[model samples]
Target: MATPGGVEVIGTDPAEAQTVKLLSNLLWFGQVVAVTEAMLLGRATGIEPTRLQELLAARSGSSRLLERDYGTVLRGDYMGAFGIDRVVEQLATVREMAAELSVPFELSSLVARVHEDALATYGPVAGEMLAAKLLEERSGGALALERLHEE
Candidate 1:
């Protein structure tokens, strides 16, 4: 892939590639949980959630996932191009694999629970972004971008 004008593609052995995929997906699942908490915390402090996302994007808190999903969540756009059930299933599978490997995977466990809770609350039909609904419940407010400008 590197032959394609500086588009680099690093190859890993199968085991490492699977490990990388597991960890990468785990990070994605965990991030939604973390960002949901961060938004709720920011709201609790009277800062608009969208403003917090902007501030984070300009600071060390930024990440491609955070910047992208932050808007999706704040806009109340749960149009999960991907299914929540699949994500939750994957998270559960990873956590189970970790356990069977006798590896400590506390964060994976937490992420699984968070996603599971979202599914329980919103049902299987809801978007994977239902993670934000947990925040909405906690903050007693909708996680919508329009609310940010009013503040």
Candidate 2:
């Protein structure tokens, strides 16, 4: 049987697949935070955020998540495809799972806390990427870019 735009896994049980899904969400949250911090540092250090986005896009640092968020972040659009509250929830689950399994979750715990702070700061409905504002507020600099929406 053929799956449409999906992968077929052999011999992996439901519990393992659930783990994979949770880990994927955790990774995505980590990606948003990591790329936001990197680009925020660039802007704080006297670089244009858009240019930083361009350089990163061209360089080995580029990834799909980075490319996807660069424009939204630079433009300060908190339009939620996903919300900070939801990411925090997922991270919380991942954190609990880590504790139950005796896994080192220091980084995950930190990221989850960061998102919790972000949710508190930005409101529960704010976009997941709204956490970028946390960096801007901390740095006292703007991450604004001229938004270019292709019609």
Candidate 3:
């Protein structure tokens, strides 16, 4: 079946599927950090309220699009069948990205801790899915940042 962006879904091997999930999650998290940084920059720069409103609207639209994409992914087992090792790998990537970005170390550590706990409590499939969803949302937020930069 065609996914939201008109992309065809393919059956993925367990290992490859896990990698995709991890990469997707990493990209999504990066997007979130980028958007958050942009928002804070805009606020600090004292951008006019009207302009801020426009940016926010654009961000919201992008978020919806990401949500649709993520839903399509979840409907397939491509990532769902991944093992715990894959989830750990994905988390490590996220943590590394967060560190490189200088994303408040404290916050990053907290998020990592929480993610570890979630994975432990829920098992790999559920944990990975949740992480994937968050990443998807972040990707949308990143699109919003691109829009704002263009404007």
Candidate 4:
């Protein structure tokens, strides 16, 4: 398929590939938001065990969904299915926003550390790409999550 800027890439349809990449980026951003929110909530309200469990369950469910989608895209052999650099850039943006908004340092630090580890292990680009892919799969359809909870 023809990539933008005349860059040729192999594997899945270019549109599909781009969609996967976009989804992955969204997922990563969501994860950062969710984690930061949860941390702030815990600090402010003192999360009960049951609430924590619910949160954990939700996080796990989301992660699983993203993993499934990422795997599918990878198995489809999409070359540009992931974009790590974009992820890092987005993360930096998130950090800046949090600082400007006066978000707690602890939460921001945690996010930074997590991203740092991810970058170290997966390399900046690959790590973000993989993370985004996994997150996208986990998010899935909203109905799917509701049904999962019912089951």
Could you tell me which 10 consecutive residues in candidate 3 have the lowest summed lDDT? 69-78
Estimate, for each residue in 1-151, the C-alpha lDDT of model 2 and write its tens digit. Answer: 1259687563457677667778987887877778878887776787877888888888887877767756777776755888788888888999989999999999878778778889998788858776677766676665775432321
* lDDT per residue as tens, model 3, 1-151: 3357885444555555545665565555443333334444554576642355356646753553243333333232224445544556666776786678777556545545544654565566533444433433444422233333554
Native-vs-model 1 lDDT? Answer: 0.76
- Which pairs of residues clash in candidate 4, taking residues 3 or more apart in a chain or in different chains? 65-137, 65-138, 66-134, 66-137, 66-138, 84-125
lDDT of 1 at 58: 81
- Candidate 4 lDDT over residue span 9-109, tens digit each: 64566666554554455455455445434433543465542344346656744564343433333232222544556566666665665579887556545
Q: State, as a TM-score between 0 and 1, how close model 2 is to the true structure.
A: 0.82
Backbone clashes, candidate 4: 6
Deviation (Å) of 147 in candidate 3: 24
Which pairs of residues collide in candidate 3?
none
Clash pairs detected, candidate 2: none
Estimate the lDDT of model 3.
0.47
Candidate 2: residue 40 lDDT (0-100) = 75
Q: Cα-based RMSD of the predictions, in order? A: 3.6, 4.2, 11.9, 12.8
Off by over 4 Å in 1: 1-18, 146-151
Clashes within 3 Å, all models in order: 0, 0, 0, 6
